[model samples]
Target: MATVFITGESGTGKELCALAIHDNSARATGPFIALNCGAIPQDLLESEVFGHVKGSFTGAISDKPGAATAADGGTLFLDEICEMAPALQTKLLRFLQTSTVQPVGATRPRKVNVRIVCATNQDPLDAVRRGAFREDLYYRLFVVPIHMPPLRDRGEDVIEIAQAALHRFSVEEGRNFAGLSGEVETLFRNHPWPGNVRQLLNVIRHVVVLNDGGLVTLPMLPESLPRSVQPPPAPAAAAPTDPASSGYVLDSLIGRPLAEIERIVIEATLARFDGSVPKAARALELSPSTLYRKIEGWRGA
Candidate 1:
């Protein structure tokens, strides 16, 4: 039951890492308490971390156990530790050093035996230098540091995460989506994903909610996803080449029926041309009226 400090950028899943560690540790059977330092007010934050005695303040109605006391025989996870007030840092440091807590308006310190796990989304070194975080506390909490990489740095994991999220959303929504369409796969793979897995989960849920009864095609995707996030469309020359050579066979349409397949192809083409009907029609070797007719057909189908 070693203390750990997890740090990463926003959306990198620091809290998840903390839970994984706690659940895997020997203290798994004990209580697992968590607190968000940034969510509590500065005035009441100390009382929340280290409980106050009755009549200690305006809101102190009874002697309550703080997060530390609540996890006496287990783990106390402090998330967003960088947001803690400077005054609280000294108190927390003392507790970490002495393994004892002094509740507000209480003279005697109560001993506690608990493992600590702290998480933050900022650079602790920078915080310590800037005086926003205490150096002594930082050293005490930095025993076993674990860093989570951002979505961009995780490479091909993006597509894997999207597929997993899509499957989960499908099961949860009771939707029988054929599978992920090729266009959808490309979009998920190429996106920069600034919001990371959280954003991808939302997009997958949105698609599952709106899907009628087929694969999640490109047309179902949100319009707000940045162009930089979407992969460039397959080259026109590649589409007409031997299907086997290009790895796009009729059977590889992800079990999508012909109508859905055609719609996906046309929508992807339109997007490739930046929504220019004339250019899309010319590129597809169809008349403008024919392109309009195909759109109407797609909508109806």
Candidate 2:
């Protein structure tokens, strides 16, 4: 395959896609090396990607082969390519053109037969236009561009993926997981999922780790999840028609638990608004997200 450029939001599995490409390529038996350009300090990046001789720099105590050399005869996956410094970009472009790498403090260049797979969360063309990335280098690596869509656009696929994650995490955590509750599934479907699959995986893992699981429930979900995503609460029992009537008992909920009363009131308010969550929330003097969480818990129960 040609030099592959993968672009997507942070949690869209760009690196995972790169790994799949490597695993299915002719170099499957060879090593699959990965480097996160953004994670490394700028000063040490060159040496890390191009190796260094023992006396190359202040911290170069011994001869070291860099990622490019390590990935020889295999696949080299570079993540956050846009974060690479300009100087490093030039060096990378040269290496791509000549199929050779010049290690730090080394006079000689070494040849490597490695497939280049790069990824970035930013749009490369936009970065190029902004001059944050080199245009020529962008074109060179954009040979086989693959864009992974965020999870929210995948519709029901979100639930499918989450269910799989739930099962896997349950097994890993040694819990008897049945599955997600219906309310949890609806929440998953409606959630914007800003963190994508990575966030979903963590959510599932959080649920599994925090409680002994029978089924994943809304209360088990993280507090950070948005409240607008939750479905409106179920309708409450009808109120008494007359306040002064002997049958109209004002003490009907006298012995009810505070939590139960809260649930009933919230549900009734939600029903009064014809299932309009925001309207119900405003009427109930609660934030929409708070209402969502409360309703999620009630429905899950």
Candidate 3:
């Protein structure tokens, strides 16, 4: 009765949300089973979810209880639900409606008493519109939908997650170093982390692995981060005497955005290097393709 549906972009902590809900619910003492709908083969996916009788398929030597049955009296998390095939979606809907599952090659339906928590990176509405996801199933699972915000939109959470990961990795790596330095903090704040928390985790793990001592400097950061995050220019004429000159004039000249400024800088560097991506990237100390992708994103914007 305490089912929930969590949705978010990849690396946006969808599974974490599901776990949190399960932990908070009355069934905290019960089992919490998680399934990645996209990881297993489609043929085996159904068997994994709804169990299978002996001789259900080639690999089945004996009857096995799937995740749903195993999670009875607890919570069952279905991750990447959009990745499930259309036919399987219908079958899942049937199970959801009746709280019963018919194992493959089984003659009778077995009642399941587990809270369902579904998650997906893909947009459910879009998937429904495309006829890839069942509209009825969408409405069924969306009863208590929770849209988890991505790390990019969470602003300062990036630093929080990074620090946590760094601490965990540092302890694991047996390094006694302090956290990120001021310079590295600046880079961490500026870099557009498209991969979000997972990328931060990877960077922290990498730093721990590459740490000569306990210090994680800007250089220790991934090439995707440190190389791309250049420092902002120094303020020109700090505290201008003329209010008109300081406020309106400066603001008027640069009305676009900081991203636009970066784009211009990259474009200028590319032109100065005669459109040689490698040379321009080297000059800017960014990956050649990273620079190109930034330009492409700007253009598309």
Candidate 4:
């Protein structure tokens, strides 16, 4: 069986991908076990990964099968694999090399036939380079690498996923929800969701759980969300520069309409930045999407 390694940012569904792999593999009928290496204490990690015999230690009142033995015939997914201690890493490497596990305080080693799937949010190779992770163990688990894309880059899929979550959470909470409003849709599109799908799911659940929703609105969204979809503020008149060199006099801009002045300043900034919208937005102290939306509105007008 081949080992699969998954890499992505937090909440990008690394465990979900691992389950998909196991469900589609030849070991579909067998058991699938998962453990978060970073969530367990370092002292107890060995017993958790490999069973400890009775009377082995203070808490060893009974014999228990560890994750590797429990998933003997199927898949064992280890999330945040890089967080494993160095001693555990060496033992893990030995298990991968020989397909055998020796339980803690046990005299004999037992052979296990199971596929391994490991996932981490950090760069495994970089961890190896810094000596935070074992180089030999890295090679063993890095047989097949899969990288999950962040939600912001997935375009309309964000809305689709959010809508699905809305429907499901609404039913679970006994709320009648229609869908998102036009303004909320625009907000979702412009939002750079750093937490990916998990953030969107939580937002939807938050809306459903708190309010009896008909249609999700901008007010229903969390206060922490980025306000990039809102229109930029009107440009204010600044101190006069050399009118002859700048061409546009500050006094002239003062008497002009707000819309006209805003257009002139935005266009001038865009031109100054060589037609780069992001650079222009940075110079104007506005979000790139907000600047683009304003320019698009001006064009349509």
| Model 4 alpha-carbon drift over 4 Å, by segment | 229-301
lDDT of 4 by residue, 8-43 (tens): 778778999999999999999999999999999999
Candidate 2 per-residue lDDT over residues 1-301, each given as its tens digit: 5999987778989889999999999999999999999999999999989999998889889999999999998999999999999999999999999999888999999988989999988767668889999999998998986767677656799999988888887788898888988988888887867788999988888888898978777778888876457533347753544657535444766788988878767766766777666678678765444565455455457
Predictions in order: lDDT:
0.79, 0.83, 0.78, 0.84
Indicate the worst ten consecutive residues by lDDT in candidate 2: 231-240
Candidate 2 runs further than 4 Å off? 227-301
- Report the alpha-carbon TM-score of model 4 versus the true structure: 0.74
| Least accurate 10 contiguous residues by lDDT in model 1 | 230-239
Clashes of each: 0, 1, 1, 0
lDDT of 1 by residue, 236-288 (tens): 32234454555555455778887777766777777777666567767887544
| Among all candidates shown, the one with the greatest lDDT | 4
**What would the TM-scores of all predictions be?**
0.72, 0.75, 0.75, 0.74
Candidate 2 CA-lDDT value: 0.83
In the range 226-285, model 3's lDDT, one tens digit per residue, is 455643332223223366676764565487787765766666666666555557767887
Shift in Å, residue 23, candidate 2? 0.9
Candidate 1 local distance difference test against the native: 0.79
Instruction: Please give the distance, in angstroms, between residue 33's alpha carbon in candidate 3 and its true position after superposition.
Output: 1.1
Q: Give candidate 3 regions above 4 Å deviation.
A: 230-301
